[model samples]
Every structure is written in structure tokens, then in C-alpha cells.
Target chain A: MSQKAHDIFFRSNAPVTVDEDKCIAHKGCTVCVEVCPMDLLAINPLTQKAYMQFDECWYCMPCETDCPTGAVKVEIPYLLR
Target chain B: MSLDNFLNLEQEYDIVVIGGGTAGPMAAIKAKERNPNLRILLLDKANVKRSGAISMGMDGLNNAVIPGHATPEQYTREITIANDGIVNQATVYAYAKHSFTTIEQLDRWGVKFEKDGTGDYAVKKVHHMGSYVLPMPEGHDIKKVLYRQLKRAKIAITNRIVSTRLLTDASGAVCGVLGFDCRSADFHIIKAKAVILCCGAAGRLGLPASGYLMGTYENPTNAGDGYAMAYHAGAELANLECFQINPLIKDYNGPACAYVTGPLGGYTANNKGNRFIECDYWSGQMMWEFYQELQGGNGPVFLKLDHLAEETIQTIEHILHSNERPSRGQFHANRNTDYRHKMVEMHISEIGFCSGHSASGVWVNERAETSVPGLYSAGDMAAVPHNYMLGAFTYGWFAGHSAADYVAGKEFSALDKEQIAREKQRVYAPLLREHGLPPAQVEYKLRRFVNDYLQPPKVTRKMELALERFDQIEEDIAQLKAANPHELMRAMEVAVIRDCAEMAARASLFRQESRWGLYHHRVDFPERDDANWFYHCHLKKDQSGRMVSHKREVEPYLIPLDDHERNAYDKLRLKAANG
Candidate 1:
């Protein structure tokens, strides 16, 4: 998809990771997978950590907003503009 | 990525307003109306067309205009009730009384509201107030109204842009702002008399959340830009706690807009499929009341929704005159569009949404002035006394008018050349090379902690654990070095994530009695402490970047509700009492 076609606020092929320190492992953070608009993140039930779906992402704040423990983060490439 | 773009920063303007949302645009319009010759520059990190609660086309406006459905007094009552009474009474009235006027002002600005078959403006919107929530329809499409005014004002609209930071004099009062063109990444300096920080509340997770197997992203640009700018410029911040949550978002997640649940008649249902609002501590009365249900073990509660009634869907279709998901009148589109029959299963499918139902921000005086001398905040950026954001309307009006006036009244001071050079170095320092911290790793951790742990109502111990974990995660932020513009922008997201964690920690630490919204579960202090804990747990920032807690007494506006309005609230309460 054209970058302009998507909301300028989001980025595709952006790096996605989770903070291990903040993860309480309540096992309730499944909303990320369920609501992944880009299908960018996956869960490793064995390791209990999420993996990235680098090929697809719309870069919205739902998963970040929904996390109860303040866990999710988003980093998009932006310049001085 | 190029040195050429760094040369894009220009030095001056007539007016520079910080945010580009409902309040910012309104402020820009107000300033233009006052001075046509003024060079007005309105900027946001994203396009103005898609920023803020209104621009995102979340839910319809909930203006407290009519005395019948919700008198300003009654509205204030509701706000105080929701806040457990910590709202500044004068602050509530200032915004509550003006909501009616704001609605009318929006109409005067040429934005159209949904009209009834009789061609009169509709007073009651569908699915509001009670089960229907059918109260006064306070117009629709806030973005349309503001946009019309912006165009008529002939204000320079820098839609896709960035509010990089603020420019201040040695004395530490705001002089202008630093911004960049979204497409070109061109640095633009907007010199103005006063600056208003309406860059709405922080929410960007520099990283994806760890715990959530997966979920939709919440806000794309709300990485606490206002808070960071204010803090860097030495502005006092407040209410870092009291973050909001639906508790039901995971149950029936879809649509990035808030209020999506309301129109769908979505409610919280526990693992047993029983309506948990009444059963759990959370009140089933308003949709927000469901937060208590899940917090109190009513969840792991999945949301239960009846899907749009087939004919109601058709009626919406008839009104919109199109078959699009968001009807031309997009007020309730989020609710009606998703054809999911069950709410719990819906959560398993779609991403999360946004709503003004809950959230906290910096504290502001009636003039919307922050603790900082020359800085001001409005809309979601300002820490409101309560959740209704009564001041968002008035505060925006005040901030724009006041900030413009402050600029007009002041004399322009020349840049201390040495200081300017120092600031320039600061801005580019991150771009020089790569720090040990990777942007993705920092972002990933920040996202997981905030969205997964902070938003849900878990136990005190679990919450404390979340807070401690956040502290350690934030440590990695310092090591993040931006090698390029994108990296710098994402690196700046650290400020946003830090503030998010601060607010979440505060929300967990305070509010021993989780009475309302998503903060309902309590293994420690398990019951509602209306007598002792019914006030707001406010947060202010310390010099150390840690949150300082304060208790704002929740006081009621003692005015009697209008006869008819009182009767309406009484009816709702009467049902509760009888039950």
C-alpha cells in the first residue's frame, strides 16, 4: 500500500517489540493478536512473548492503548520535518 | 535523513497554535476572527483531518445544552458523580454551561447536524443516555464543523505536520514552536506570541506490548507530545494517573474510535455469559460502568452485544443514503457497521477503539493555563477535573484567544545566538549516530506495559509489578540513539512512553477503592469506599520525571437539577434503587 494511502500516523515495516520488564504475564494481552489490524504481531505460547508480523501493519494505537500494564510501544521513522 | 531538510526550518509567523484537533482548530479560527492579518499556523504530528477524538470520527458530541435532557447543572452532577466529586466546581460550570453555546457555535460555523424527518435538528441521538442513551443529539461530526470554520478563517492549514517542540526565551515563556512538514520532513519554525499545547494525551507505545498475543493499535500520534514539550520547556504537569479503559474493549474490540460499544448495545458479560455489570462492582448503568465488572472478577468478562437490529440497520441505511459502513452521518457508524452477533467473539476478531470515556492529563486552571508560566493545555492534553472534559470546549476557546493575545501583547526578543546554537545541537544530537537501544525494542516494551497492564483493572500487587517493570523498561530509552529523522521521531516517542507508564503507575497506586470505569477489581480494598475514596486521584509531575499524587476533593455543584432533568436522572436512579 502507498504510504500516503494509510493514515500518516502509522508505518509499515516498522520494528515492533515488547518490554519484558513491564510484562506481568497476566496472559490477558491476547487483544493484540485478536485486533491486530496489520496482523503484525504473533504470540509464542511457549516463550510467552510476542513476535512481529513485519510484512503487514497499519500502525494504530489500539493495542498500545488497550494494554493495562502500559506495555505496548510504537516507533516510526520520522525526520526533523 | 538529509542535511538539506534541516535547512527547512523557517523563523516566523503571526500565530502558532500547538495542536491541530477540535480545540486547536477552534483556537486558530478564533484567533483569525480577531485578527485577519495575523499569520496563523496550526500543526499536528498527523494530518489535522485525522487527529484528536473528533477528527477520528469516534462518537457524536455529548454537549450539555438543553435543560430538559441534561441541564448544565445535571451534567455537572453526572461529571461529579463519575469523578466521585474531585472536579473543580467552577471548572465544571465554566465548560458545562458553554457546551450549549459551543453546540450552537458549531452550527453557526456551517457544519450540519443530523436532522429529523420534520427537518428540525434532532435532539436525541440513537443509542445514548440509557439503553438507547437517547439524549439530545449535540450535533454530529465535530471535524466537519471545525474544518468549515478553519477554511472560512482563511487560516494557513498545515495539515500533515509535526509539533516538534516549543521555542522559549531565556526567561522561560513560550515564544513559538518547532514543527516539520509531514511529507517533506522540512523543518519549519513558527514564531508566535503564545503557544497552546493541545497535542492530546500521550499513548504511543515505542514498542508493541509483550503480554497481548495481539491487539489493534490505539492512538497513533498520542505519544504525550504535549507533556514532553511542556516538560522540556519546564512546564509543570499533573494527573499522570487516572488513565482510562473500557474493560470491554478486549471483549468486543473493533473500530479504532471510542463509543463504538455504545451504539452496538454492547455490555460486559463474564465467563459464564451472565451480565456482570449488576453482579460485579461495576455499574451496568452506563457502558463505562462495565469497567468495574471485569476488574472485580466479573471478567475476564467478554462483551455481549445484540448486533444491530436488522431494521435499525436499514433505518440507518435510509438516513445515510449510502451503503458505507460509516453512514454519511457517522455518529453511530462504528457501532452499527460491524455485523458481529456476539461481543465476546468480536473481541477475538477486531482491533481496539478510542473513546473519551476515560483518560487523565495535565491539570489546568480555568483559563486552561498549566502550572507553567506561559504554557497552556486544552482538550485531552489538559488534565480535566473529570472525564466529561467540560473544559475541552471552553479551554480551547480560551487557550487560542489567550495565547494569541499573549503573543500580541509581548515584544519579540532576539535569539541569544549562543542559545540558539545550543538548542540546534540538542535537536540533532540523536541523529549523529546510533545509540545502543534500538527503536523497535524500546517501542515494543513501552507498548506492552502500557496497553496490557495499565489499562486493565488488575490486583494491587500485579499493578505494582507492572509499574516496577515499566521503570526498568524505561531505562533502555536513554540508550536509544537516533541515526536518522525517523529514528529521532521514534526516539522522541520515549518521552510519550515514559509519561504513559507514569500515568499508569499512578492510576494503580491511587484509587484504593476502584468504583468506576476500568479500575474496578480490588483484592486489597475490595469494596467501593464512597465515603472516603469518592474523590479524584490526581497526579502532577516532579522535577525527577516521577509522578506526584494529590487528592482533589470531589465536590458536587449543589444546584438543583431542573425539574424535568432531575426527573430523568431520578428515573435512572430509581431503577437502580428498585433493583
Candidate 2:
């Protein structure tokens, strides 16, 4: 059929990461997610652990600085690095 | 992400502040202080705890008007000359007069400014005529202090609502705000007696040269939202042609921070490591020299810090890395560049419209009131020339007190139901579409066109073509598809960028003479024509809703500048350099 549709997926390494061992998102603490200015961090529904859902990070580091248990780290995006 | 349950969430407030950044918090706090009984709501698209340009805090006040260091009259004169004499002296004078009080207020609130052993504000000479740059070695916790104050003031804050439109009554006065939640996609119908917009600069208007969408000098969250919101509500914006193009790190897209390093003896140098300009204060004239050197074969400029002592370099690294954009240290480390041995490379930033640095914003008077009746604006979005952080705080205070007095006996105006429905349909069309262009892709194309055609050394023909392209991008905005509320936010921001682009083209074309150096350097109109173009170029939406441009006569100078002071910026080239 001429009605074929396609989507392109671009892969990017999230500059921000959450150390799951220290992350307390499973205990209902959402400080990191709540404080991010770019709103890039979110908790995975299945794992209940915080992760970077989108690669559009400003690397502003509120997620890292505001984490209660020191679970997050912000790296310079690879493109700028 | 349907709007079914979110349709009935209507709330009322005496005053609504639309950003939680630098000025918005101050506005909210001051309004609450003016009358503690008033119901004020402070909101941001992101959490207010970490939002705006100072989300991570700033290194220092770029323009601090302290008592022992400089006088208000002197500071006002410096800004008047630096901005090439199109300033409303009354507004700048008001900020200068109240600058120290604002500093004292922030100091009392636990935000510290650097002081000498004698406990005076350690102001340094960065401007050609005066000493205004006051450092804050421990300014990293400014947001924490403001947050504490916000809590103490008992102001209500709603996070994650991206305000897309200002709701005005039949009498054409701003009465409320319309927005949606970025997470739940809840449509917000916030009715207020007065609305204050503290959205930061139009940082995302020009796509960065690195081709990265979020790579910008001003925080990427400041996508010209306030300017768009104010313009759509029929506010006059001044100096839109005076684009904000800064000398930033080559690819990092953050400030190398001339204000911080310059006071400690670091200077901007060419390939030969020769200082061309006498001062490191950011002015259009200084940028003109930098541009000349770049185009005149000494192409790449560098922040010359290698010659400084190791202790000085460490102090710079401590302040530059610890505050504002700490990831800057990592960017330098990745490139193997260190202040101890290697000079950092620098480039001109993509163009933007920010009154904080270069004086292009929604027009406001001495009281921070816009041309509209119940609308006010401050921060980078307010048109106060060379007003940096201190200006934002001062003007935010003005907007708060003035707005409090304005709504003293005022009642809430009726909300226009038709306007709310139309804006709702406009915001949600992207989410309802099955297939369309992505918001990010459309933004990239629009901003790349901005860099190509609108970056200065502007030609009349090229600017005309930019206007035509911007018209096409408006049509493209209707075809944007957002799968969720986050993408919906980006889609709305793209519309703001398009409005700013059109304003840039129209404002630049309206002013027929070159002024503000690289900011509005029209190649076709290569000289400053004070005889014909001395007046301020004001732009607004006319009665028919077309973007119209006009001229506003410059007010008579209160502190009159002599001939020598007027030409001070023109003679910035150092005499000792290669002489």
C-alpha cells in the first residue's frame, strides 16, 4: 500500500545519569526529578528507578546538586565535549 | 494527554507572576510584603526551586551600584553612553538610584556579595568610565536564599505550568493567564488582577553554531516566551533590532565570563595574544573591535589567562566552575585546555534579544509597568539598558510595589471565554495530529535561518528574505505534532521564536542606520544617522493584528553628557597595542 509510514530514531548517550544504588525514587523521593530545570529526568514505571528520558539536557546540574542521596551526576554533553 | 479533566481547573489571584527566575521570585516576595494579605501566585514551566538563569546561581553582580564604590548619576551616565544614547534616562536612573537598596535586601536575605577586609562591597572597574562589577565568590547559593525568602513570604507557587498566552478583557487589559502543565497536560485558566512576566531572554531564538538545539548562552528554557506572551497581549517592544550576540567559548556555548576573569587581569586577546580593547566590559564598541580582529586575519579570540599567576588561575577556576555553569570545567577538561597553560578559544554567540546585556525587551516605564494597563515585565525581558542581575532585582521590586498599589482597590476582570477556547485549541492541535513535523526539527530550521540571514553585518535584502522565510515558518508551526505535553511546550516555544524572528526583521529594517556595532550593524546603512534615526524604534501589534513598527522620540537626558563622554566608547582601542 502507498500508505506506508516510517519513523527515525536517533540514539544519544544521556549526559545525566542516576546511580540506582543511592537513588531513593523507589521510596517515593522525587527531588532530582522535581528540581531539574530542563525536566529531563523521570522514573521508569517498571524499575521505579530514575532515568534520563530525553537527551535534550542543558547539563545545568540541578538534578545532581539537588539529589538527596547523591544519586545523580551530570556530564558535559558529548557534542560539546 | 487529553484535556478532558483539566478543563475545569480555574483559580483566581490578586497578582500572578509567570516565572520563578531572577525577577519573578523578587516580584512575588515584594508583592506579598507590600500587602501580606494579597493572594499572589508564583509559577514556572519548571520547578521554581531550580529555574531561570540563576537556577544554578551566578558568580557575581555584573552591574552593582553600591554607595562607596559608585554613585547613581555616574552609573546612569555610563549606561547612557554604552547603549549609544537611546536609553530612557528615567528608567535607568530609577534602577541606579535603587540598586544599592536591592543589594542590601539580598544581603539581608543571606545572599552574600564579596567584601574587602574593611567590609565594603569590593567593586571593580570593568566599565570604561566607572567601577560597577561586584564579585560574589559565594554567590552559588543565591537561589537557595531566594527560595527561603519565598517560603517565608507564604506565596503560592505552582510549578510545571508553561504560560502560553496572556488573557485580556474586552477593554484590552491583561486580566489573567492561560497555560498547561508540562507533565499532566492540564489546561490552566489562572485569573489575576495583575500579571508580571519575568521570563528570561529570547536565548533560544538563534540556533547555536554547534547545531545543538539546547546549546545557547542564555538558559534554553528562556525561549522568548515572555516577549511573545507580552507582544500577543498588545505590548510595545523596544530595540528588537539590537540583537544580543556575545563572545562565548567556541563550542561550549557558555560564558567564558569576562566579568569574572577580567577583574583578575585576564583579557580578551587575538591569535598573537595582544589586547586590542582597553576594557573587558561587554559593550557594543568592545565587540566591534573583537569582530574587526576576527575578520582581519587574527580570526580566533582567546581569554588570555595563561600569563596570570597559578593562584589567580585557581581562583578563576573555583568561581567559574563552582557557580552558574559548573560543567564548564568538564568542557575545558575534555578539550585539554587549562587556564594555567592554554588560553580558551572564543567565538561570537548566535543572536538573541536580551535587555539584561544589550537592551532589547518589552517596553516598561520607571515603575516596571508595560504599555498595557495591568501588565508588567522585568528581568532580561524588561527594556532597561545594560541592567544585569541587580537591575532585575530592582525592577522586580518596582513591579511588585507598583502592581500591589495598582490592584489595591481593583477587582478581577471577567475572563474572555472565547479567547481561552481559541488558545486551548491552538496549544492542543499539535498533540491531536497523527503525523506532522517535530517541534525540534522546525525550531532547528528556523534558528539556522536566523543565523544565516539575521546575524549581523545584516543586508537589507537578506533581512527582507528572512521576513519571507519567517512567514513560511509560521505556517509550519500549525503542522507541528506533539505526542506529549513536553513536546507541546517545545511547539509553543517555536511559535514564540517565530514571533521574535519577525520582530527582529521588522525592527532591523525599520531603523535605517547602523548602530550598536555588531548588534545592528546594517551593511547597507553603515553609519549612525542621529539626525534621522536618533529616536527609539518601537514595535507592536497594530489594530489589525499586523506587526507594526514606529519611532519613539528619545527623552531629554537628565544627566547631560558632554562631547568627550559621548565619544568615550568609540575610542576603546588601546593606544599601547602595537603602537
Best by the DockQ measure: 2
Q: What fraction of the native alpha-carbon contacts across the interface, defined at 8 angstroms, is recovered by model 1?
A: 0.00
lDDT of 1 by residue, B1-579 (tens): 434446646656666777676678877877776666677777766556445644423334444344444666656655544444445666666776777676667657655555568755445422223211222223234555676677778877665455666777777677767755533445666666667777765545323322222232334456667766776666644434444443323312223222333443544455556553332111113333443333455445464544557765454334222211121223223334342454342122111111133335666766777766567778776766433333466678877666666666567655454545554555555565433565655666666665555554447766777777777876766566664454566666665566556655655577776554333445577566778776666555565855666666654555533444432311222233224
Deviation in Å, model 1, residue B117 alpha carbon: 4.3
Model 1 CAPRI rating: incorrect
Give DockQ per model, in order.
Answer: 0.03, 0.81
Best by lDDT: 2
Candidate 2 lDDT over residue span A1-81, tens digit each:
568345576789889898999999999989988988878889998989999988888888888888889999998888787
Model 2 spans with C-alpha error above 4 angstroms: A1-4, B1-6, B576-579
TM-scores for chain A over all candidates: 0.60, 0.93
Lowest-lDDT window of 10 residues in candidate 1 chain A?
A2-11
